[model samples]
Target chain A: MGTITVEKANELFWLGRYAERVYTTLREFFIGFDRMIEAEEAYIEYCKIVDVPNVYESKREFLEKYPFDTENPDSILSNLYRAYDNALVLRDEIHTETLSYIQLSIYDMKKARVSIAPLIEMQKVIDNLLAFWGSVDDKVDEEKTRSIIKLGRRVERIDLYLRFRMSCDKLKTEKNKLEKRIVRTGLKYDESKLCELSSMIDSGEILLNQAIALIESLVEV
Target chain B: MEQLYKQSEVVNDLLARYGVKFGIYKNGNFKEQLFPFDAIPRVITKEEFNYLERGLSQRVRALNCFLKDIYAEKKIVKDGVLPEEFLYASSGYLAECESIMPPKGIYSHISGIDLVQSKDGTWYVLEDNLRVPSGASYPMIARELCRRSSPGTFMENKVCDNRNYASLLKQVMDYSNTGGINVIMTPGRYNAAYFEHSYLAEKTGSVLVCGSDLFVEGDHLYYRDYTGKKIQVGAVYRRISDEYLDPMTFKEESVIGVPNIMKVYKKGNVALINAPGNGIADDKGIYYFVPKMIQYYLGEESVLNNASTYLPFYQKDMEYVLENFDKLVIKDVAEAGGYGVVFGSSFTKEKKEDFIELLKREPRRFIAQEVIDFIDIDIMEGDQQVPRKADLRAFVLTGEDTYVWKSGLTRFSRNPDSFIVNSSQGGGFKDTWVLSQ
Candidate 1:
């Protein structure tokens, strides 16, 4: 076995982030989709919450395009493709069975044509992503590799939770996981900035803009 | 075999699920295409496999000896067994590799020798791929999937288990290891054979690295890891071509090459699998001399025969080629992967005349071969079994000893009338079953 190079580390980190981004956003898309069926403009609010441009004319259009659009950089398919691109290079470190989940998700997203059917079809995507995480934890033997990937996953989850306005407690749990992985991986980070972000989150004085900035700046991997 | 054919669709689905694909560039855009797998395997009886084993081993050993001799003593050239002009005129003969002996004195550690069986049951060697030969993983993984699809078929048949190709590969790498970790160096994921590179690395417990992941420092090759730790690389199974291996030595424009890697290799600090400059032996022009090489180096009759070949470089052979222009297949020595091959019968009268003129003007640039009427194998086309042109690529590994993998890659052309069966030429592959009894 070879030591993970800095370039590989960056890829692993981004792989985790993109995989989690697809999973979390797909779940969020389901909720937005259900609401969009009742109101045509509900998806615009959802796009605003996720910080993506509300390019679609209506909620129905957003539901039709967001999950499978290749052109939209923030679409579920794009994130899944990015996840696959990153995982493809790390096959030596990541088990194939684990990587297969991401591949299946990409395939499912591409095959999905009926707009509403994909909202339910994405359940397989969710299952695969969860299985992918479990496989990473169980199958990956390298400490640094697992830690680096988990760090990316947790950081992306925290960013998504904050943007989607999940409970502060949930955000805290995700942040705590990220912090542990950061320490375990021994990746360089701004320790003071991390502590300041934690204090602001704990004290309930955190501005959304400032917290997002701090989270983005926490790790440079 | 019937059960395997019945379950072909399911097996193909599984292959796609596992992402068994090869990438190709079309109009300068990269596209990954699934390498279709045919359920009906090409069965080789134990007796036939034994013959192939000996022939492939003997042929590869002679080629290795030829490489070592040409690089060191030039004895074959001096003894008049091989012409000095042929040795020097070939572009594959790297001058920089002169007098530098690789670890274990092995040049072609892994050889993929392409062969075709004629209708008369005679096996003829078609080409020798000594440099970064691929397609072993295709059959290796195909067998895995096939066995899973029909366990009863495998149980009923006394076929040699080919799952040990990974272990065999590991052994070769281990035998060639001079010091540190073994690594499979790739240009990147975009290369045509990137899947094989990564799959072999995963199976052999070697690191799969790109050029930037590796560097040479103080006469040793090292792999830089994510945490900024450097691991020394003892042996490298580099998948890139010779000209793109080391930027400082060969192609200076290659961004995929590790600088000064040849320096580390030259100093004997690291082992390069199928050591560089092996293209000299695999060159199409040099192929005409392999049987002679076996006779000269091993002092034995060649077990395998080269396809009936005529070198245009020789005056008598050139005359024969000219007379038999409409029946022979002419090949450019510089090209491979089923390229640069022209069947004389397929050409127009004017085109044939033009090709003959080119051959006459530059006799050293081409070789002509009698078109062998190779046997066709049955492959499932929809629900019907059809015969298609196919060829086997037998892999020979040289380590502490020379060993030929029992099973080989059987690639068949999908087009019924097409003779070319390279994957790059839209051919699909079948599992080669070498029966134990």
Candidate 2:
């Protein structure tokens, strides 16, 4: 692989973050969606957990708009579009085959928006996302490129896990993974913040807002 | 062939999946649209390919010679073969590039020569795209997907592989490199040919960069890596136009342009592929003088024929254009990509008079050509075969030698009544196949 410019490195980092954001949120939406089928206003709690505004008024509105609305920047479709935007520019770094999976994911997201049975199409979106990551690992030969994206993926996954209030074991596993991955990326980060997050994770008591803030600012492009 | 045609949708789906798209600005809004692909390949026989190979190489070589001479001595203009007015009035001609020879004395390294075949089977050169010619990636990628769709179709036929466009491109850059690395510079992802730029960079193993990623220091163009280490760039295949390449040299207001890069180029510290000031060679007005340029420079008759073109700047040609106003197509020399083009026959009487007045006032700004009835190729429209006008854009790569890629881009108008086949004008493309047998 040739030299990676600062601009391309920034794009690679965001591509990883956005792809993981779509994948994790889609999964969370699925779980909340099932709960909504039995209890109409379950999406209210779902919004609070995901830290997005409760813009939808009714169960039908949430079901129809939360996953598909492009105007809402927090929607699954919007995040998927962001992932596509980042991946589109990183074609040389990620390779075309890996980039195609993101393109395919966007297509599936669009198809899901109109379908009566949208889960089938959304499932395909998740499958393509998985394939995108797998292709990145298999085809992206540049160790730094792979590590940067992996760093982004690790950061985003831990952020989402903290938001969902997952178990202490889950947090430690992801936190450890992030600590190992960040060093390999060759990107500059605030080491003190990462150490602070480690202490928080090790203490078995985490402040949600402070931890998410630390993770967001840990890496510098 | 039938097998390939039947799998058109599958192939198209793959194109979309891979984001094989071109961006266009519609009403000041940028939209990336899928360039529709017709599965039926445009096959050229080995004999025909060989003929085109010779003619295209000859034409590109002459154009390169013309570029070298026009900037150095203006010999052709002095010898009365080409008028000085055409050279000076051309918007493509840059005074900044005068007398500064490129690294290899090569201009127009990768030329996209557009051609159309008449119904009578004679091919006519339509235009020469010397500066930033694109669409090679469309056919190259399409060929890959076509083979994937119908491997049996390819196995049964003897088609020359066109997948070596990257290596050919690499050779062009490598041969032109002064010392260090090769990079493909793009304006941004929003540009129409961004897909080609990035894909070619990936294929050629060159770093893809934008203007902000590069800087000039001590008479050298350097690419700054993420680590803040500066790597010297010996050659840059810049996809942006000349005017937007160096803000200090061309368009000072252009934020996308690298400052002082032209200073590096002028000093022979770096090479710019297809070199700046190349637009002067491919100017629509200069295109009328290419055959004469071939004779004047090479002392040989042009191997290819240009369309019957007339410059209204000349008295005799002006009279001929005025007399046959309805039979010619008028084009603005400054415009491109199907814009500023008017079919004379389509004009009303009042519009014709108004245009004639404008033509007489700015005769040097326009050229007239006899509208040839080009041959049509069948394209699939909902399982039905329909004929549409098409033109071929053949790529010629000049490195140690001038090479014509065996395959070309065959673009056809989607509209039944239209002659314009620009992707921006809603045209579809077919993969051009050069038959080995």
Candidate 3:
């Protein structure tokens, strides 16, 4: 019932972004993992797509260490922890039932090893994230806070989709949702940059490097 | 109750799902661990609870009056009921809090009075926790899950619902509130009792805030929202200790405290739950004088007895403690959460002599007590039920009137040999059920 603080808004937005990142990246990691089983260089491509430095010595090392590694700042576990850290602070805005999903995801991530069984176990992370977002929409009554978090989620999703070379149509839909949330939140952003990004997204002549730069600069808050 | 015990795993799983945990620093790293819940409820008969409620209420009232008198007239000291030297020498007595009356003349709006029952079934007050007492939410949420797990069990029993603790807390806040919204101020999520801080805020419908979320402007406390909207704060149920409450007043290096907020509290523009400087009354050394305080302030004999305690500051007690060093439990007055406690018998002869030397060197810093042979409650460990040392922390709330919550947090040591039952000491909790009958 209280207005979200600037610090809290930042946390909620990043909570959405990091949780979405973990969800999307873990799903994508499986695809890359399957390919890596066939050819080890498939991980290099995956690293390039996510823009994380290839730190592991071999594909086996990457598969074994990447998902659960706390040292790797861009690992799914790290992202999940970030999401939890952000969500923990926003317990007032987010319902306990909703926050519990994030907590469960983190707990499962800790339990998950580099074993083949965990590849299937990772689906629970995605399931929990979906449940988390659903619970947020239903349980969080504050429209602005929800919109801000959704905006963060949409932005992160669009960024990941573009980088991962997902379908253009999916990117456009997500970008459109992001645009609407950006407007709904009423937070300040570069209107011209958003329009420019929109034009580039629409023309399909969008250079990945240039588009990533524009997306990064799109929202300041 | 048997049905509930059978569903212990289910209740614990639900607790895990709800993030029911407490944070602790282990090996210099902050870790959050589940405060394990035992299925067996600590059931208190209605008659026993009635007696406890009255006694707890009276004790807390006397403590509150003592705080008021200490800050204002010092009548009890002047009347020779309590020594002035003992009052001023206490580390908990804040000079800045003198003559400052809290809203509605209430101090310690929430009091966690720890009591242990002897084998003979007579209860004795172990200690008073007037400063930032926690653990209420543990039992409160546990009861919620227990009822859900076995609805028929609850229906069959005459248990008084403990779900109203939050509402009762809210009522106290509202009663003592000068104006505006109630806020629960936590140090942060890293603090030991962070779960309780956030849970109580959600239950009471108060804004849960850290020190950074609040600021003092124009001598009134205000909470800043994400949208940069400033809302005036009426009551603050701060979970941080007094020393870290206001950096400007107590600890200047405390970054977790809001600067000038104590100014606001002093001005009566905002109400602070369990007003600042309450530690003076709850200090272990001062605990020896509580019964005297009851008689001095309330003009009535204490219904509950204190664990036979001896303050080393008194020459007679010091001599007695030195002579009986091997039989008493020596406690450092300033420490809490089961720390700074030493069983004299556990110390070697050399160590006992060293401790005796330290006690003589700083007599005021310690107190010795005849350790009560406290009663144990049954806890379901795996398939077997075992008796473990447990203690009740009965919460007493004072606002317009002093009242005790019928249900309390019953914490027990997981180790069969340990007497310490603090959550920080790797203890677990059980839901306390006060029979409505």
Candidate 4:
């Protein structure tokens, strides 16, 4: 129940979004990387399913640019940078020990960038991101702060799950978690939109775009 | 000590892992760089530290008295101990702060005094930084990691634990609280010392906030939380400068400053640590009279030495400065961070003449001092230990009384030829150990 300003709330919310973005995207990138070995143009299907622009000209270009290119807004490195941008400002709330894992993730990403065996290096990046979330859960003592971050995490996972056309059961589980966590955050949110999104998931045939829009605009921070 | 030095890389890697860095701006782009750590500490014996503790306390006390006098009675100026021109001409002097009594009448709650030791073992005060002094956290955190890196070095040595800085700081803020919560207001995360600001806030248990997070209402300042709940803030360890602290009172164009917060401060509703208008006491031109200030206010001789400084505004000092122009170092009064400092000997004949002409034209803008060839400390370079120039910034916290921390920040030049040890100028830092024995 510690006091957090509107600005800090915004940072915490986006910190959740960006950290989740980097985590879910990195996990997706690994799967895509495996597919690219057998099928060189497998990333095009990833771009289509994930709703990102296919900017890579070839399999070689996709492998080099997908996770490492900072210029590409959809790249994993860009998402990690965004996560760092939000976490850097929230050091007082997140605590340094919690934030250092994010710092380590960036360093791991930089190592992956110049790294000869990048996929091997990227495995550490994923490990650091996982450690970051574990630290966030263990170190952040305040209930409201923890709840907001979890809400953002749950919202993002659902968005990505919807984009990947995940199972109705998987989407419902994330939706149930978000519904339970949102009430604990003390943040202003569109409660009606949450209910509507929940009903759409329960219907078992979700309109993916409308559900993504609902989750993005759910929080008023 | 050898054990600690052997593990320097491990300690540095831990520092980098913990995000121990400072931000710097170059070509309009901001980048954060690790503040390089030198494992070799500058050790001060108990007796030496006792002497420094007394001297630093006296100097800070006199400076505080001068700030009170400058804003109120002008007794130091009236008594002829300090010149009036130096008081008014100082860019730090604020006309708006006249007769505004801060909470508990404490002007400088925290003072960072820069000091250097000459080859002859004589210590001289280089500068007094009263406004938003940083680098305390650098040493504090380094000490923590150093002990973790080599606990035996601390066990074998009698080095005092320097981790009480946060408690000391909390005491200052709590002592000055006007009946509400404490907060550390920063410009944002892009500031050069943002790491220190956030770290201190975490350590001291104060909320770290930017300008937009706070507001003034009915002569009181309040912090608005995310849920729109208003919490009154009693003490603010503000890291922003005076001009950017209150947009209504200072620069009208500053978006990073709270509007009319000064009105709340003036009303004695909240305390601003190292209260506004302290720049007047720490001005370089006013530094010439610090010895006289100690004599006038405390009726005691200054235990610390001011590095044989001469102001060209005085007829006698001007003649001596002109005669010994090439042997002295000239510093611009308005600039800091090692920017406006120059060695007279480094100037060419034509450039020296032009500089002398400029100095003569604007005598009040600069102060000339005899260069103190300070002693060099050993820092590990590659494999061999080499001597490098270093300076110590001793932090003094004034609350119910003046208390100087036993440990300080010891910064050294990474380049062997340079004397500028500012972090912004590519300098590295070491922990200062005051031996308990």
- True-contact fraction per candidate equals 0.74, 0.74, 0.58, 0.75
Kindly indicate the candidate among 1 and 3 with the higher DockQ: 1
Off by over 4 Å in 3: none
Error of 2 at B217 (Å): 0.2
RMSD of 1: 1.2
CA deviation > 4 Å runs, candidate 1:
A114-116
lDDT of 4 by residue, A1-221 (tens): 26898878788888898889888888888888889889977889988987879887998888888787888888888988898889988888888888998898888888888888888888888888788888988988899988887887888899898898889999999999988899999988898999899999999968878998998898898
lDDT digits (tens) for residues A43-134 of candidate 1: 77888899999888866677778777889888888889999999988888886777878887777776665534775568888988998999
Candidate 4 Cα errors over 4 Å, as ranges: none
The per-prediction i-RMS, to one decimal, reads: 1.2, 0.9, 1.5, 1.5
Model 3, span B217-298: residue lDDT tens: 9989999875567899999999998988889898999998899999999999999988999999999989999999999889
Least accurate stretch of 10 residues (summed lDDT) in model 4 chain A? A1-10
The digit string of per-residue lDDT tens for model 1 on B1-437 reads: 79999988988887787777899999999999889999999999999999999999999999999999999999999999898888998989999899889999999999999999999999999999999899999888888888999999999999999989989999999998989999999989898887888889888989888888899999899987766778889999999988998989999999998999999999998999879999999999999999999999999999999999999888999889988888999899999999999998999988888888898898988989999999999999889999999999999999999999999899999999999999999999999999998
Score residue B99 of candidate 2 by CA lDDT. Answer: 95
Error of 1 at A140 (Å): 1.1
Error of 2 at A98 (Å): 0.7
Question: In model 4, how many backbone clashes occur?
Answer: 0
DockQ for each numbered candidate: 0.75, 0.82, 0.63, 0.73
lDDT for position B314 in model 4? 92
Chain B TM-score, one value per candidate, order as shown? 0.99, 0.99, 0.98, 0.99
> Model 2 over residues A1-221: C-alpha lDDT tens digits?
54898888888899899999999999988889889889977989999999889977898999999988889999998998898898888888888999999999888988898998888899999999999999999989989999999898999999999999988899999999998899988899999999999999999889989999999899998
Q: Please give, for residues B140-197, the per-residue lDDT of candidate 2 as tens digits.
A: 9999999999999999999999999999999999999998899999999999989998
Please state the error at residue B81 of candidate 4 in Å. Answer: 0.4
For each predicted model, how many residue pairs clash, with residues at least 3 apart or on different chains?
Answer: 4, 0, 5, 0
Each model's C-alpha lDDT?
A: 0.89, 0.93, 0.89, 0.91
